[model samples]
Target chain A: MYQLLNHQRKEKLRSPFWTKNILMNILLGFLGLYLIVTALVVSFMAAGFIREEFEGRDVIEVFTAFLFYFFIFDLGFRFLLQQLPALSLQPYLTLPVRKSKLIHYPLLRSISSFFNILPVILVLPFFIMIVCANQTGLYSTIWIATVFSVIITNNFLNFILKKYFVKRPVLILAIFLVAGCLLYFDSIGNAPLSGYFAAAVNAIANLPFLFMIPLIIAALTYYFAYHLLRKNFYPEDSQTTRSRPESYSFLNKYGELGELIGIELKMILRNKRPMSVLIFSILFLAYGFILYDDPDNHFNLMLGGFIMTAAFAVNYGQFLFSWEGSYFDSFMVNRVSSFNYIKTKYILIAFSGFMTFVITLPYAFISYRIGFVNAAMLLFNIGISSVLLLLFSTRNSTSIVLEKSQFLNYQGTGAMQFLMIIPLLGIPLITYIVFLILGIQQYAVFALGAVGFVGIIFYRPLLQIVVNSFVKRKYVMSSNFRKK
Target chain B: MIELNNLKKVYGTKTALSVGQIIIPERDFTGLVGNNGAGKTTMLSLILDLIRPHSGAVTSKGKIVPETDEWKNYTGSYLNEGFLIPFLTPFEFLAFIGSLHGKNSSDVKDFLNKNRDFYTENIDSSKYIRELSAGNKNKIGILAAMLPEPEILILDEPFSNLDPRSQSWLKMKLKSLHLEGVTILISSHDLKHVTEICTRIILLEEGIIIKDTKTSPDTLVELESYFSVQV
Candidate 1:
């Protein structure tokens, strides 16, 4: 087993994927640290509430609510890993391993992996701070609850995600939505599902029932997932096709790269996995509108449009390298230039960004656009920013790790996003702010153009630098691409 | 004719190839036999100008340095993943390669028509290259190299993934091409196939040519002893 694992990597280590993996992991570790720090900062900012409300709030309530939120978010991530039905669980089904033991392995693996650890580190301390502030004898109860919550959430989420793949995603989403509503809606004020757990904690104020939910969810999800792991469970099985002799005429229209890129395009649309992230990004856009809830604020309106546009581009553009997974080596041998490859990706970004623009146009029109000047400015920003995002993403491609697994999983994003911190949110801010300061908000449109034009020219040099980096680091990128 | 003069290569500090001097006469089928990391690929890459040598250069035809246009126009080569476009259908991949060799996609298909079974497979060319099986992928790569009908052909581990039937079919094809005076260079570790088909053999050890022989291995025992191995 170990040899097979190492052997798969042997060929790849010589490929570019290996170096990319190392660089990405280092970047990922740092990014996790940054996120934890950021989360800590945010929680710290909210600490004033804990100090003020310490006496009325039973600190145990805070613990329960924390676990509840963890459960809610983690359930999504776990499912995406298909942890419930992943290759990681293959041995348990037949190796005389107990089903419970087999299922627990993933739970254990999850706990050991950094994603869970980072969150635990970020949130648990806050829970402890709340507990200490209360001086309530609730230490043991909270610790147990925390452990239970992590395990159960991880397990349950894995199982549901596997189940989601086993079923269709749309169906699974509908199920989760309905279940989430039914489970907690009727008992909102009383906090029905969580209320009982809250009550248990209140009774002992110091009792640790936090761990129970995760434990139950983990055990139950495992029981069903393992039971369902029948003879080489392929989450991708339903998508597989039996070999058949077929015509090549369908390739005609694509010209040269067309059939290839077209087939790849079809693969992406069919996967529907990334669509989940697309939905999430859209939700994030809606949240932006919420941040600028005041409709009368013109500056806020423009700010919202820029963000909506930027998110529309970057969110979709991030997965560019991954979409070419496994077949990327083929790209090197083919005659397609790196320019065309990157150009095609930019086209995809533009297409998707256009959709987002079209979808949100009424919103933009309602808020501010009354003339072609406004409309054209918005269009230019959308087109230009999307192109710039692809250029930056080309550099980041060396750092991104796209896992060829059941969709909706963590894509091994790195501190690569830090590069975006200044550009994505920054430039738009500076331009809009400067324009507002100058009392000429309209001129900001030209600034957007200038920034974009520089980006276009800069992409050429960036392309040279990055493509050369890619050639130098080709072996590393290819290897890591295959590993995950 | 293909010529190698004091060709050398190094991976970091490790020597990969160090052929002192050799000449591949026109119209000869040469089999390059070596183990994994035995520098077969390095030798082939140097000859193709895919990688430049540290000490010596390979000249194709009569040129000291191969002009990329003329050299590429008349040569068809495939090694590992260097022959495929993963996003393309096998048909698309073949067409793309065919185009590079100044042949249209339809011309490529027409060329393969005489070898229909060879070109035919239980894979949809409309499907992406990533979707094809290894054996079928080999079929596409082989076809891409062959469709151009180049004056020279270089293949690496060409039969590794092919089924026995496909292997036999390819062996016959190689024999036919050799008779047409097309020079062929094949790199592989399979001694039986190499000795059976090659007009001449070059055995490599530690990146240097250890043995070059013209003996016909008409019998199994003679073949084993030729490489100085006790079987």
Candidate 2:
């Protein structure tokens, strides 16, 4: 089993999907490492805060008391991001490999997950502090063992949780709502869950034999996961997998381009990655509360203006042409002209920017400056940023698998996408900054709006340029999309 | 009519397609034949403007394929699964295709009814094109191209995944369309069907056209003997 995993890793590294654009891969790798190290440093800092708050009490008891919340937080995150055991186990199921051993492979693999190690990384230093503080070795050791057992228990519980929730997604929402209600009750002191947790932690430390509870829980969870995997490992029966017809006809009322937009909308709603991005774009509307709450910060307001107006554009536009990667060839050979195709994208995103602008009007009620700046930014994003994104999208040929979760997957992301962000967001922000430094700070907003209006006025010429570029790269894009 | 003038396409060091000069006249039932890697699909792609040639051009009715959208108004083609919008149902797909050529949903329904025999199963019940079996998916593609009643039709391996009954239905459909002077081009490895329906057959080997001739009664026997020698 270890050899099989090792071979899969090596084969994955050899695939062009991983090895392409070596420099970009190295940069993203470094960025990831930087984030992890920063998180570790933050955890180290948090350990000090814990000691200061819980002074005069045994640090082991306080830290152990907090361990339950940590496990809950980690569980929520792992549910969202931790990949299912997607490795093809079907091939081994046919072999002489024992079902017990096959199930154990994924269980063992789950323990090595980055998510399992993250909590350990955060809490390990706190335990070391307790050891340094001259606590009883046996008591400290029991606390440490209990925390690790809790982490392991959560890890195995995740496998069962995900397997069940995948078949019934509404159950996932219900579980989250229940967890939220528990936390709410505990917060309002209606339920003293925290006090109960602290008492349990003290019991585990004082009576070292009580550590057996979490150990038993961990063992049972692992057993449950094993049985679940064994029973549900094969493909679902055809009856359960049959798909019902789903139709969307709202956009058909607008004629042919409306039909195209309707398809695009359906694609976004139906696919996992696009749906997540769409949701994220909506959530980003709340960013203005953080940025514009203080009216004096012009810099933050400008930055917020860019992000708010262009939220949908950035999230949806980055994968503009690639979003249609699945059926791009069909579009190319169909009756749709290259110009009309580019025009349709421009109108769709421009309209999205307009809608985002309208939804953001409430921000203006908070502060007139935020309101006016956002209005200006909305114009700029629709006219300039959206056009730039559409033009750059003509160059994107990577075929993205729409089924996979988008968060941190980065499966179809390429160097060009990263580079395109500069022109899409950078130029407009730079134009605003340039005008601001020249003592025309108030006029800067209008300048940005004017530039955008100019872009809209000459939309035909701009679309022609995009159309030509799309035609030039059409063959390469089609061939690349065909690769997967 | 489609004309390929000094057309060439290469991927790195290998030539995928190279046609010095070729003309497929209007109303001709032409069949393209080749083994794997023989550039049959590549040639069809170049003609349909799915790929850009390294040199020269393909023109349909005196309009360059890439430079003008005029050819698309009359051209209906299905090269592979890439030409399908897999998320849409067959009914939606046919409707969308019909709309592109000024046909309404009723027109598409009429077309479906006209060619019900070509679809071996009830396609309207399927949720999406992706859920249908391979044979059904091919039926969707072939019928979609034929929905517009195009002046020019190109299909790559139209008979590949179809059942025998569907294949005969398609052959009959294509024969009638050919009689009505709708130009048709088909690429297939099925020598029997190609010989039966196509007036002309072109054989390709390793990116080069080795034979282009009118089909006769003995065309299938001749092709088998020729391939037996080549192998």
Q: Report per-prediction Cα RMSD to one decimal.
A: 7.0, 3.2
Candidate 2: the clashing residue pairs are none
Model 2 - which docking category?
A: medium
* DockQ, computed on Cα atoms, for candidate 1: 0.25
In candidate 1 chain A, what residue range of length 10 has the lowest lDDT sum?
A397-406
lDDT of 2 at A215: 92
Individual DockQ of the candidates? 0.25, 0.64
lDDT for every model? 0.61, 0.80
In candidate 2, what are the lDDT values of residues A1-484, reduced to their tens digit?
8776775577558767566667667876797677568657756676577668867875555555566666777787777777766456767768887777766776777787778777778777766765545678887787778778888988889878877775454566677668878877876879968668878867887897788998999999999988887777775421234465566566667677876776777677667788767756876777777888787677677777888888888888888988778888888888886676787788878888878888887887777888788888888888888778988888888887776664566767887788998887677667767977896666776788888888888889988888888878888898889888
Q: What's the lDDT for residue A221 in model 1?
A: 65
User: In terms of lDDT, which candidate is strongest?
Assistant: 2
